[model samples]
Structures are given as C-alpha cells and as structure tokens.
Target: MTTGAPTPAYRTSTSQQPRRSRLRTLLPLGLAAWLVLEIWLLTVVAGAAGGFTVFLLLLAGFLLGAMVIKRAGRRAFKNLNEALQRGTAPGQGGGNGLMMLGGLLLMIPGLASDALGLLLLLPPVQKAVGAYAERRLRQATPGTLGDAFQQARIHRPDGKVVPGEVIRDEQ
Candidate 1:
C-alpha cells in the first residue's frame, strides 16, 4: 500500500536538533567583560596620571607604532629581495611582515594589543614565530610548485603532461 519513493532519513522531532556549544554562548559575554575591564583600567590610569598625560602617552604610542610599521615594512621588502636573489624562499623574510603586524597592533588604542605587539616585534619572539610557521607550512605541504618545476620529468600513467602557454585575448 506504500508509495514507491523511500521515506526521508531526517529526524522528525524538534528535540533531536543539535545543541550549540556553551563556548559560543559565552563568547560575547566574555568579550563584553573584557571590554568593561579595559575601560575601567583606562579610567583608573587616567585618573591617577591626569587626562593630558594619558592623551600624550596614547599619541606617543600611535606615532611610535606608525614609525615602526614604516621601518619594518621597508626592511621586510629588502629582506625579501635579498632572499629571492639568493635563491631562497621569500617566506624566510616573514619577520618583517610580523613586525609590521605588531606595529599595526600597537597602533590600535588598547593596552593588551600593545603588549602583544611589543612582544611580536622582539627579535626572539619573531624568530620563534617564524620557525613555527615554517615548520607548519612544511608539514602541511611537503613540496611546492617550485619543486615541481625543478623536477626534470614526472611519470603519470593516467594522464600526460601538456606543455603550453596561454595567450590572453584582450577584448
């Protein structure tokens, strides 16, 4: 007496719906709490040091961060060029980029971000981060496109390699 079509596999009850994680519910609360704490800390510091002094300190931090960004960006580009010339991966010069990011973080008006930025700008921290990133990248992808280009021949039973260049047709 049943139709030819099979029944759907989905659950019929509303209670069967997946429950969301507590972390998701708590994230906004945590962020709001942190923001309140930061505001309170800033207010206390300003009260102790005077508003004018706090303004000057914030201005100095912003200016210092901008200068660091400019200097680090230049140095990173220089290092990238040198690495390329020496037949090394451009990623080896990622420290400069990290420094620039640190500088950017410092430019943001927050004590925690400024502290993190300063840490990232440190030579030892930059080195450690760079090494960790390099290790992860290597583990994720054993060989890159550059390695494929360096290989003389590739053996594939399923498909033949087609060697050709595409000419863009600009309309």
Candidate 2:
C-alpha cells in the first residue's frame, strides 16, 4: 500500500482518440479494382462490337446524362417556385438528387457506371438508397439536436466556428 503508482485518472485513454475508418484504407484499392474491371469490359466490348460502337455508346450516355441532369434541375427549381408561391416549405421525397447522381454516374464513360446510374434512376432503387442514407446519417450523429450544441458550434453556410452557450430555465 505504501508503494504507490499513478491512478487510472492520470493515464491517457486510447479510446478518446478518433478511430480510422475502413473506407479510408479500402477505398483506393476498391477504386483500382473497379478501374481495371471497367477497362477490361470496355476492351471486351470493343473486340466484339468495334471501337466506333463504343465511341457512339459513350456519346449517347453523355448526352442522356446531360439531359437527365438538366431536367432534374428544372424540376427542382419549379418545385422551389411552387413552394414559394404557396408560402410553405417544399415537400421532400422527389428523388431529384438521386436522379442527378445517376446522371453524373452515367456520364462517367464506363459501362458499369452507366448500368449503375440507370439502376439509380429507378424509383425503387432510389427509395432504398435514400432510406439507407438516412439510416446511416442517423447512426453517425446519434444525438444531433440536444446537447451536441452545448459547446462551440460550426456555421454551415460560412464554415465558421464561434463560441456559444446553451441557456435553460428551470421551473
């Protein structure tokens, strides 16, 4: 009892340090594999259907993706106008963002990406992806609204951090 060591409070906890995500390690590798696959598929198609056909296909995909993006943007603007006219917030669940994402993927010049984009353009796929994204966001910030704002907060629009305090009144 006389021979004393530092208490647990004096020791630093490793848990307090931020953990690395698997995605950080695996994403590069995954992208490399995908690139290789895309190249291989393109070569195979070229061998079967000539180089000009691939060029035509890519051009068509680019044009279609552009059209899709333009349409989605217009629709989103129209929805915003309609909401402003009604003096109410715009309703959600239109999948316009997903459509834009699909368009982007389609324009990427890879058949696999085009296929994935087309899949994302589908209503059911958009619903499933949106649900999954929502769940992931909820999980990432488990307690977003309440005590998370107790300390200094970051302003989203300007990316500024300012000190602040939360005031509560008890009855």
Tell me the spans in candidate 2 whose CA falls farther than 4 Å from its real position: 1-19, 143-171
- In model 1, pairs of residues that clash are none
lDDT of 1 by residue, 1-171 (tens): 887989889858779877879999899999898778767766887899987877776677688799999998888878888888999877655577788888898887766667778899899999999889889988987798677664524434556654555579999
Cα lDDT tens digits, model 2, 101-127, are 999998999899999999999999999
Q: Using alpha carbons, what is the TM-score of model 2?
A: 0.72
Alpha carbon deviation, residue 167, candidate 1 (Å): 12
**Which consecutive 10 residues in model 1 have the weakest lDDT in total?**
150-159
Q: What is the lDDT of residue 23 in candidate 2?
A: 100
Top-lDDT candidate index: 2
